[model samples]
Target: MILRIAMIGFGNVGQEFASMLLARREWLLKDRGLDAEVLAIYTKSRGALLSKRALDLGKCLELVRGGRNLSEYGPESTSLSPVELISKCNADVLIELSPLNIESGQPAIDHIVAGIENGMDVVTANKGPVAFAYKRLRNLARSKGIHFRFEGTVMDGTPIFNLVEKTLQGCEVLGLEGILNSTSNYVLTEMTSGKTVEQAVRAAQKGGFAEADPSLDLEGWDAAAKITALANVLMDADTTPKSVDRQGIGGIEAKDIERASSLNKKYKLIARAEAAGEGIRLSVRPEMIGPDSTFWSVDGTSSALTIRTDLMGDLTILETNPRVTQTAYAVFSDILSVLESIRAGTAH
Candidate 1:
């Protein structure tokens, strides 16, 4: 089977996924009997590339890595927007790796809609769409009969959504609790060691774990989005990040960290979603936990989630100090799953 891919948002994660796709090309063909080709790559500022034939992902990665614009490729470059390119490019899968828009899920939702409407399977690492409009997009995909998968939106490559969908069959997810934001966790962990909040944030940025504008992570918007996404999909809690009662790590001081440590506790930004009446309540707050807590040992870029279910009681998943490659693997794994569904004639 040959899968043609069109990607919107070719940023750090996109570039890294492209590299992984290149490296695993042979493995995909030989093991999975799948031949995948990247046909279109769209970026907000960098430039866009679209082709009827497979675009040279190697050259694209090289150019972007060398700090050159994708337009340097010359002929294959196009001026079309992502949605326009989606209509033109004959792709089997659409990959969305756009940056998170905490305010509203914009162009990312638009991009995914275009893909599903164009009769393409959609995969995304962006949490905005799921957090804001999961039900709408999911209904659209179901009506259009296409696979919509988003495993990388939270917990890096860790299988949260897939675990429920594939393994925990018939289990009702009652609630969710997690340390979802790596940047916040890293910052708090540093602060426990006597570093100031500002110093910890700067260190996180330098380590490439936090965005240049770490406000999203520091202000709790990132965790809010992640928790909202989890609730929307797993528990059918139709909501957005705005609905989350949130507090960030910004309120933590050097003294606060010291207090927690003196009490034999560690501060972590926890995201929780639980049943409330007929709906769900979502919250992100910094809470100090002692060694007995599952999240106590989950420090420094590590993320952990606990799922409360009817049959399973409680289940937890963890990913430690994930980097870009894990996120790339999320995309890769989703693509292969799509291919399997396609082969089985069950892509819907």
Candidate 2:
């Protein structure tokens, strides 16, 4: 069975995912017995392209590298929004890689809904929809009998969600604490070395870890969104970034960093969500952790999550250095999961 895929965004993560798919095509077909094709691609600035036939990914890469739009490709090209493409494209899966809008989960939320309603499985790297509307989308997918997976929402393709779902079976998740934002973590690590917050943020931006407008990362909105996503999925609660109490690293001073160092501790931006009575309590704050703490050793652009469970006790997962490729790999892993479910005759 050929799984036709429609990509909703053409940015850095999208480009990396497409390239990895092409590079691993033969291996996927031969070892995994899975065949897939890219049917359509829709970009914000580059227009859209759709075809009933399989799209030439190599040609798509060429077009992207040359700084050309999809409209310049062929007759099938047209300037359609992501919603239009999702409604019209004859694809088995919809890959949503668009920019996240936590304020109002637009375009991405609408696109995912359209795909599920049209009888297609949805995979997304965007966190807005999951953070704001997980229960609604999950219920919609359940009623439609399709899978909705967002493995890249939290830790740039870390297996947090999958580990909870697949590995931690029969164990109840009581609570979770994590360093969810790489940009903020990088800034704090740099600050510990005597660099000012501005210098650290600039270094992060140059390293491609922080965005040009990093208000979300610096103001704790990014980590808040991630923790909200985690709470919705693991704790089965509905929450948003605004609902999560947030505190960023911008307020940390050189004296504060030095004080932590003097006490043999490190300041880290930690996002925590725990089961409180019937609801979940969430907060993102800068905390000084001692050497014995699981997060104290996590430095640089790395992330760590410690899940408190009933049967399994405390489980800590760490990603030493996560990058774009790891996030792309997360998307790829989700696709393979969809395919495996179908192969097992479980996918609806």
Candidate 3:
């Protein structure tokens, strides 16, 4: 069967996926009987519609390279809202790479619901809706018998979710911890080297590790969102982002990092959610990990998740880069795996 695909939010990550589909067009068609193409793209910005073919890459890339949006490159194409596009598009799969709207999960939620309701499989990089309303969405997918993939959400391009679902099947996980936000990690590492939060944050921004408005990362909400999603997938519960107790690294002064360093410790943003005696207690913030700890070595924007379980104690550690890759192989890999599992009549 052909894997006809459409992408929402044509940003850095979405573009990455588009390039991947183009590069691997022939390979997927040949090897897996999947013919993937970016059938449609949606964005809130009206300027995003200024381009060609409604699916042109050269023009889209030119816009991105110029720090302009697709709308600036446009001439002719239907302009519709994201939800409407999902309902109307003739795509077998809907790929969601929109920015997280923490309040309502907005356009992401709207797009996901529309896609699945219209009998389309979905792959997402957005964490807001998943962290907030996973059970509802998954149940919706279950009822529709459509695939929903979100590997890039928890950790960029990471196998953490799949590792839990596949490698650690039936494993009773006791606790979860990770450097889930790359921007925070990079900033904290710089702070540990004597840079101020302001300074480190600037460096991260210059390095493209942070957004122009980086409050989500500075506030710990980003990692919190991912951790909450993990809790739902690893355990179970459609918990909201507000449900997690959050503490970002913003309050962390350079002195804190210095003091930790002097004490043979490193400051890292550690996100943890545990199956406590009463219930699940979740937290995300900067913590002082000892020099010898695994987290201490996780410098830069790379993220690592450590899963502690009843059977194997600390069983597996998974890592993923902070940035979306040049291609969408990571996301495609997730889709392929999910498809293979269904073909085998297995749970993923």
Candidate 4:
């Protein structure tokens, strides 16, 4: 079965995913017996290009790398929005790789909703929808009998969600705590080495670990969004980034880092969500952890999530120096999972 995919964003992760898909095309066909094709590529800057036939992935990559519009590839470009593309595109899966709008979860959420309503499976790396409207989107997907997977929303491609869903069955997740934001972790790690916050953040930006506007990472909103998504999925709680008690590392000075280091502790921007009295407690804050803690040794752009379960004790998953490819691999993983579900007649 050829899985026709309509990608709704042509940003960094989107381009990487497209490249990886093309690079692994033969392997995907010969080994997994899964024939996948990108049918359309849409971007806010370049407009939308749709082909009923399989799109030329190499050409798409070339056009994107050359800073040329996707519309130049022979398909008549439509000024249609992402929601319009999702509604009208003849594709099996709608891959939402757009930039996150933490405030409203827009455009990405709208795209996913339209995709599911229009009878297409949905996959996304955008954390906005899951952080702000998980239950609504999730229930809509179930009602429409489609798949909605966002494995890249959390720890990039570290398989946090997959671990909870595929493994750890019959065990209850009591709590989860870890470093979810790589940019913050990277900055903090650099700061511990005598670098100032601005200097460390500059390094992160230069390395593509931090965005141009680092407010999301420095202000703790990114980690909050991630933990909110985790809580909604694993704990069955409805929460948003605004609801999480967040404290960023932006205010931490060099002296603070020095103090923590002298005290034999490291400051990490930790995102924690756990079962509270009658509800789930979520927080993203910079906490000083000692050497004995699982997250204390997690340095650089690495991320670690420790899940405390009733039966399995504490299981910690660490992802070291995650880049755009890791996140793109998460989307690819979701695509394969969707294919497997289709083959097994369990896509819903």
Candidate 5:
């Protein structure tokens, strides 16, 4: 089978995914009997590319790496918007790798809707769509008889959603707690080693994981979004990030970390969603834990989640320090799963 792909964003994760796809081309064909090709790549400012035949992903990576616009690819480049590409590209899969719009899940949601409306399977690593509009988009996909999957919305490529959906059948997710934001967790981990919050944040920024304005991570909004996404998917909470009772590490001083260390404890930014009556309650806050805590050693860019399920008791999954490759793998694995569903005639 040949799967044509239309990607809505060509940022870091998207670039890494394309590189992986190129590297695994032969293996995919020989091992899985599948040929995956990128038909279109749409970017916000850099430009877009579309072609009936498979576009050269290697050249696309080269141009992006060389700091050149995709339009420099000559005639293959087009001036079409993302929606137009989704309508015209005739791709089998729509990969949404767009940056997170925490305020409101815009253009990403718009692009995904266009893909589903155009009879394409959808895969996204953006947490915004799941956190903001999971039910509606999911229903739309079901109505259109397309597959919709997002395994990268939380914990990079750890397969949180897939774990619950595919592996743990008949189990009910009662609540969840996790160290969701890499920046926040890394900053707190650095503080444990005697670095101040500001210095730790600077180090995170230099390390390329934290944004220039790290407020979203430091202020707990990132964790809020992750928890909201998790609850919306696993527990059917149907909520957004704004509904989180949030508190940031901004109020934490050096003395706080020092005090925690003195008492054999560490501060971690924890995001939690618990079943509350017919609704779910969500919160993100800085809390101190002792050596006995599961999150005690999850430092740097590492993340961990503990899922409370009725049948399986408590299950915790941990991912060590992750790079863009993990997130890229999330998209890749999701695409493969979509293809599997397609082959099995269970996509709907």
Candidate 6:
């Protein structure tokens, strides 16, 4: 099968996908019996344009790394910005990995709504818009009969959606919990370095684990958003970001970390969503778990989610990574899985 992919965000995750699509071109064609093309990538300003049809994968990577090109098309000056690209691009699948704006979900929400309306399938790693408009956007996609796959939105790309959707199909997850944010975890891990929370956050941003505005992860808003997505999709509940009570690690004073050390109990951003009767309760907060506790060991930007099922009781405790390398691979895994299912006409 052949496919055309429209990548909406050219950030670290977006660029990672581009690189992956290039690296695996030969393998995907020879092994998976799949032929594909990255139509284009819409980024902040004049996006990137590469036609792998003629260029070798290695040459493509060289151009991307140098931020220059050797094609008839000049680099950076010939492509549309992410916004204009979303509204104007053409493709069978739209990969939306744009940055998340919690307040508006802006471009992402608009992009997704527009994509579905135009009859294009969407796959994303952006949690802000999904966590904000789960019901509205989900209904829209379902009505349009488009596949909205978002496997990398939560974990370090640990296959959470289908882990719950398909693997535990007949079961019920009463309690969902995990280290949903890696930025905060990294900050906490650096507590012994004597760096202030602000200093640690800056380091995380420099390392590409946190965003320019790290409040989303530090304030627990990022984790809250993930919990909200889980509740809405896995639990079949209609909930919004505001509905999920949130608390961040921003308020943790230097003394608190010191105190935690004295008590031998550490603090970590724990996100939880529980089935409370007909309604669900979700929250993101920094809690103190003991030295040997399960959550206490989940450090840095790595996240772990444990699902308490009815039949199997407590099963696997899944973890998600924050690196784009892992996340982008997860994106491709999901893309191929969904595409294969679609081709077989057996996807649900």
Compute each candidate's TM-score over C-alphas: 0.98, 0.98, 0.90, 0.98, 0.98, 0.88
lDDT of 2 by residue, 210-230 (tens): 999988899999999999999
In terms of TM-score, how similar is model 2 to the real structure? 0.98
Model 1: lDDT to the true structure: 0.92
Mark the 10 consecutive residues where model 5 has the least summed lDDT.
339-348
Q: lDDT per residue, candidate 3, 1-348, as tens digits?
A: 655566787777777776776777788878887755565777666333422223666666667767776656545355777777777777777888888987767768878999999988888888887888788888898888877888778777667777777787788877898888888888887776678778877888898878888899989988889899888777774577788889998788867777887898888888898877768888997778886677767887778888888776795464645556822556778778766866776542
Clashing pairs in 1: none
For every model in order, what is the number of clashing pairs?
A: 0, 0, 8, 0, 0, 4
Give the per-residue lDDT of model 5 (tens digit) for 159-233. 899999999999999999999999999988888788998899999999999999999999999999999999998
For candidate 2, give the lDDT.
0.90
Tens digit per residue, CA lDDT, model 6, 1-348:
777777777667877877888878899999898876665565564335544343243554565566864343454234555546555556667888888777766779888887788777788888876787777887888888778888888785788787887777789778788888888888987875588888898888888778888877888878888888777778776777777789998888879988988898888888888877778999888888897767777877677887778977876565645567878987888788768767876533
- Residues 11-67 of candidate 1: C-alpha lDDT, one tens digit per residue: 988998998989999999999988899999998888899888888899998888888
> lDDT of each prediction vs. the true structure?
0.92, 0.90, 0.76, 0.89, 0.93, 0.75
Off by over 4 Å in 2: none
User: Model 5 scores what on Cα lDDT?
Assistant: 0.93
Off by over 4 Å in 6: 48-64, 68-89, 316-321
Cα misplacement distance, residue 190 of candidate 5 (Å): 1.0
